[model samples]
Every structure is written in C-alpha cells, then in structure tokens.
Target: MDTNDKHYRNPEAVLDLYERPPLATWPLLSLQHLFSMFGATVLVPLLVGLDPSIALFSSGIGTILHILITKGRIPAYMSSSFSFIVPSVALMKTAGYAGVAQGTIAVGLVYLVVATIVGIAGSGWIDRALPPIVVGPIVIVIGLSVASSAADNAMMNGKHYDLTYFGVAIFTLLVTVLFNMYLKGFWSNIAILLGIVCGYVLSVALGIVDFSKVISTPWLKLPAFEFPYISYTPKKIYWDAILSFAPIAFVTMAEHLGHIMVLDELTHRNFFKNPGLHRTLAGDGTASIFAGLVGGPPITSYGENIGVMAVNKIFSVYVIIGAAVFAALFGFVGKLSALIQTIPGPVIGGISFILFGVIASSGLRILVDNKVDFNRKRNLMIASVILVIGIGNAYLQIGSFQFTGIGVATVMGILLNLILPREALSEE
Candidate 1:
C-alpha cells in the first residue's frame, strides 16, 4: 500500500476521514465535543444565575460570527472558557446576581475594545509588544491556579463523604492522561468521551449520581428566553468584576494567536499570512462582541476542536460552519441543554480533566514556540510576575476600581515586557 494510502497525506482528507466532517457526521462529533465543553458553558449560567439556554444560544451564534469575521477561512469552534466560572461564582457571592449580570455586560464591552485595538494597531504590532514572555507563564498560571478549586472539589465529596469522589476523580484524570498520551487514531480523539463513559459508569454503580433530575426534565421545550440585560442594574456594576475581567482580554488575545498557529500547522498553510491574524483576531472579537450582546458568555476558539480538525484532516470550513448551524439550532431547544446537564458530574469532570489540560498546554507551547529564554533576568522577571499575580489573585485598588487575577497579571506583564530592555549581548 502507498504511504499516503496508509495515512492520509492531505489535511482535508484526514479531516474528512476523522475531523473536518460534513453535517451528516456533525451529530456525533459535535455531541462529543459538546460534552467535553458543556460543563463550562453551563457552570457560568448556574453560578452567575443567568439562563443556560442563553449561554448555549450565544455560543452557537458566537461561532457563526467568528466564522463570518474570518470569512469562513478558519475551521475552529468557539465555546465557553472555564477560566470565567470561578470568577462568575465570586461575582455572584460578592455582588449578588444583579451585580454579576452588570459585570458580565461590562466584560463584553471589554472584548469590543480589545477587538478595536487589534483592528487599529494591526496583528504584527501585537506580537512585538506582548510576545511569549508575557503570554506563556500567564497561561500556565491560568490553568494551574484555576484548577486548584476543581482539584479541591474532586478530593472532597461534599461534607459527608471523603475520598470516594477523590478516587473517582483521580481515576478519571488518569484515564484522560494515559489515553491522550498513548492512544492513537480515533481512540485518541475520543479519549475524553471514553473516559467520561467510564466515570459515569462508576458514578452510577456507586449511586453517586441522581438520575431523578434527568428523568424529571422535559424531553422537549422552547429554550427559556433570558433577557440578560433585564438583570443589568447600573448600580450593581461590581468594579471588581469589571477591572478583573476586562484586562483578561489581552491574555485571551494571545490565546487566539496560539489557536491560529495550530490551525496553520494542521492545514499546512500559514493562515496568518493570508486571511491572516488580523482577520482571525477580528473574527474572535466579533464573536465575543456579538456573544455578549445576545446575553451569551464570551467565546474563544477551542484548541481541542482544532486538534480534532488536525487529526481528521478535514479542511473544509463549511464543516465547521455546519457545526455552528447545528449548535445554533440546538441552543433553541431547552431539552438539549437539559439533556447535557443530566450527565453525571464525574463524567463531565472526566472530560474537563482532559480538555482543560490541553488548553493550558497550548499556552505553554506558545512560550516554547517563541523560544523564550527563561534563564535571562528580564525574561524570568516577566514570567515570574505574570504567573504570581495571575495565580495568587494579586490585586490593586485605584479610587473606585479594583484590578485583580488575570486582569492584574496581564497589565503587569505588558508593562514589564515593554519596560525591560533586550540584553546588550544579543545571540541568535
């Protein structure tokens, strides 16, 4: 057999075979990716006390906007980011539900500003000022710091049980790690799905999952129309959420750069050089802007789905477009979101363990790609400051505004990067 026959040489062909599949194949692939990301999409709404259907609907529409902004060149799926989940929880606790609503609306506007910044300065300028020194460690911090809570929850089975959920979580995590590392072909791509299946089985056997909610949920119903702006109280715009999340758009913009790079590698085309980073950045911004407007959470291009496209070698943007259409349709169906919510926690967590890790690793890859010299004093300083401030919840107060978490870290990194001069002794 020819080498090309044994392994698909064309990215489009591989995508056709495995990743860039048409509408007919979307149900399975979309469902699989959906499960991996569903917890994140729902968690924000549940915690912030917003309607989950709106989140789902916005996510669907956001993906469409992203595709349109990029002129349907990039094949990536936009979804919820877990980074916002705990923040949403904190916003609710500190400022009440109304405060969270106002804060989220304000946060959406931040995305618009970031999009505008990219539009004005152009994409090349973004790389010069921010670079990997600022972006890499911050992403590592984003993953590890945000993960502490999940790890803690996994260890404690509420107040009553001990070590049971911990064991299950560990088992789930191990399966994800092993499968992603060792498994190949379709198995690798579906590792999260399989791991979730195993975790669900165990949860059922242990009687940990309550199926009553699933049973009681209606099979079909119109999505509850959530007027997110309805809850927007001007007095309740918590400065903490506004300051803390707004600057995060910077790091998120860096994250978009990584996604574009991966797509370029998968497609064997420097997408940035053509339809370009500027176009993709505009796409991301538009997605975020439109998503926010529709009472949806902020949308980011999913690296996991890009990996799916890379592995499958399906390069047709239409496939992703079709996926977007499906997501949009499903968003209007309350039963769809409800059905996903019915999945056992451990199962969802099992999938999250894999996907989230992949997200963090993608950030590290950015640092590596830039060949950041960690040994240098300037580079080390930038990396250290960003990671600490980002993960340690470093905060600053100026008059009525409060800056903390990723927001604080992003601003700090950008300043340090610009101020710190390159070494006199330059080496190639």
Candidate 2:
C-alpha cells in the first residue's frame, strides 16, 4: 500500500502530524519533549566525562537528521544511549576520548550494515524471530539492568551514603509523582522537569550545589566540538578500541529493535511497516555516526521521550523538531550547560527512579496488552531466565571481549524462544 493510503486508513494519526498542532503550542510541546529527555541525555555525558553541551548539541543535530531521514513520519527523539556508558568510560580510561569516538563510529557502521540487510530481506523475518515472549523480556532487561545505578546515585554523598541525599531524592520523587498525578495539561507533561527544578533548589539550599563553575562560565559560548581524527592526540586510529566497542553494536541493535516495537505498540501504528524498519535503523545509525564524529555519545531513540509521549499524547513531528532545535541552541549557551552540571546527583537519581521504572513497566504492559500466555512452560521459562540474568547482572567473558547483563539476557531470550518447543497449557 502507498503511504497516502496508510494515512487515510488511520485518521487519528493525523493529530500527530507536523501541521496539526497550533503554532503557539509548538514551543510548549517541544519544551515538554526536551525536558522529558534532558535529564537522561545530560546524565550520559556526566557519567562518561564527555562534555554535556556537546552531547546535547549532537543529540539535536542527530535527531533532526533522523527526522529528515525518516521523512518526519516517526515521532521519536534521538539522544544518548545508556548502552554505551560502560564501554565509553572504559575506552576513555584505556584509549582516551579519541578511541571512544572511533569505537562509536564502528558501532554506527554495524548499524548501517544491519539496516542494509533488513532493507533487502524485509521485516517479516523479525516478527517470527522475536515475538512478545522474547521482546518483552529484553525490554524488561533494558530497564531493570540499569536499576542499581539509580539507587547508587540517590544515596551517594562523595564517599558514603547520606541521609540528606536520600531525603532530597525522595522529595524529588514525590514532586514528580504528585505533579504527574494531579496536574493538568502542560504542567503534567513536564512533571519530571519540575521535579528536577525543585530538587536543584533544595540542593542549593542545602549548600550541596557548587556555583563556582556556573559563575565562571560565560553566557554565550559554543560547545567545545571534537572531531574524530583532528581532535585526537597522536592523531591515529585505535583498532583495539574500535574492536572492543564494536561487539556492543549487537546489543544496541537488539535495543533499537525493542524501542521500535515499544513505539509501535504505544502509537498503535505499524512503524515497522510504514517507514519500514530498515529506514528507522538507518536513520538511527546515521545519527550515531554523526554524533561519534562530533565527540558526542552514541544516539538512539530515547525511551524517556517515549514515556513523555505516552503521558501527553502529543506526538507531532514538529514538536520533536522544535525540541531538537532548542537542544542545539542550548549547546551554544555555556552558562546553561554549566548550570545543568550543577544539578545534584540525587535529583537525577530521583528522576531516574521514575524514568527507568516507567521503562520496566512498559515492558510488562506490552506482555499484558499482547496477551502473552505465561501459563505455558515455554513462555514462563523465557521470561524467567531473561529477567534473572538481566537483573542479576550476569556476564559472559571470552578472552578480551565481554557480554553485559542486558546483552547476555537479550541473546539468551532470543535463543530460548527459537529452540524451545511452542506449547501453551490449556486453561483449567
């Protein structure tokens, strides 16, 4: 069927189109998307010691690039992927930022190859290969695997856990929940951002916020852009770093698929069939490559933005475009970046508790929504093993290479679903 035929069949989807929303509401909705993704996007750079402004800048450019590539049909925001955090940090320590950049480029290349294969072979194979039994558990792993990081940050105070930090974190969490539940319209849509603002204020009141950096930073300044080859010292490629990080592309590819599936379910649109999964994958890959070359984190479709879309029901492509533009503009504001850095860890921790849990809950919802038969031994086994391995942080190592909790769980779930016999126990 033609794209126009598809659009005519689903009238509701027109609301999410670029021209539907009033021009005045565009910025506000865009702000909601930006705020929804800001906490996590900035956190990636903070964790890996990359410049947050550059990350934000790249995210903006990457997202715009994605929208352009996808013909603005998919209403997804591209940002830093959490999957790259561990490898990126390790690469920085071992081979420096240049190596990390190269590794990220390698990952993008892997995505491009996968996209090419999917484009030729079609997405029908994907459905038979990864049903809800496999996809649901992998989604759960994506969220639960990083659960501990939230707790660690919430309780952290330099070297030890602090009651004050916990108190602030709880306060932030409460604010977010309250706003999300009680507020209406724009306020409800920006609950997380509001919570962060409140938490930041509380932290400043408690003397935990260091203003020295913000005070010194200029109002208007460009992001410290780092090019792949030109920015590196010794000016050479690191094949070892590239190889080490390249394997992670397998994991992220699975994650990319999961994101598309979740989005399909949420939007009630067949994204896999519309733009075709190949285009989406290619768009994401192109964004990642651009980000890597610019010394930013690997970009992907953000789950956090997905959560916001679930809540607000505003999926206009123009809204995301506005957000992307704002993000890029913010990157040029030196003081704005500094101020974001000054936000205490606990505040981020508190917001993460909600965001990550939202992801986990979404996975559960997908299973329930699809009516996956857990009574079956095959289904039960797949779900149980995936959750345990992922949450338990199991790892498999082979010489210099390693598979993380989510990675191992994703691979195992797919293998189990493929090998195990298909049978459902009859209802008693």
Candidates in order, TM-scores: namely 0.74, 0.88
Q: What is the lDDT of residue 1 in candidate 2?
A: 42
lDDT of 2 by residue, 1-428 (tens): 44333353334342454455667766776876776677788889889998889899999999999888877878788999877787788878987788888888888888889889989988897777788888788777777777788888799898798999999999999998999899987677667778888988999999999999999999998777787447655367788867877787777676677777767665667778778888888899899899988889888888777766665556677888999998999899888777767778788788878877877877898899889988788899999999999889798876656777777887888888888877644522
The lDDT per prediction is 0.62, 0.80
How would you encode candidate 1's per-residue C-alpha lDDT over 289-398 as one tens digit per residue?
Answer: 56555555666776556544443345556666665666677676656656667665555544555554654665677788778887788898888888888778776655
Q: Which stretches of candidate 2 lie over 4 Å from their true place?
A: 1-25, 46-49, 85-97, 228-236, 424-428
Scored by Cα lDDT, where does model 1 land? 0.62
Regions of candidate 1 where Cα sits further than 4 Å from its true position: 1-19, 22-25, 79-110, 159-161, 181-184, 227-285, 288-326, 332-335, 363-371, 395-404, 424-428
lDDT of 1 at 100: 45
How well does model 2 score by local distance difference test? 0.80
* Clash pairs detected, candidate 2: none
> Which prediction has the highest lDDT against the true structure?
2
- Residue 193 accuracy (lDDT) in model 2: 70
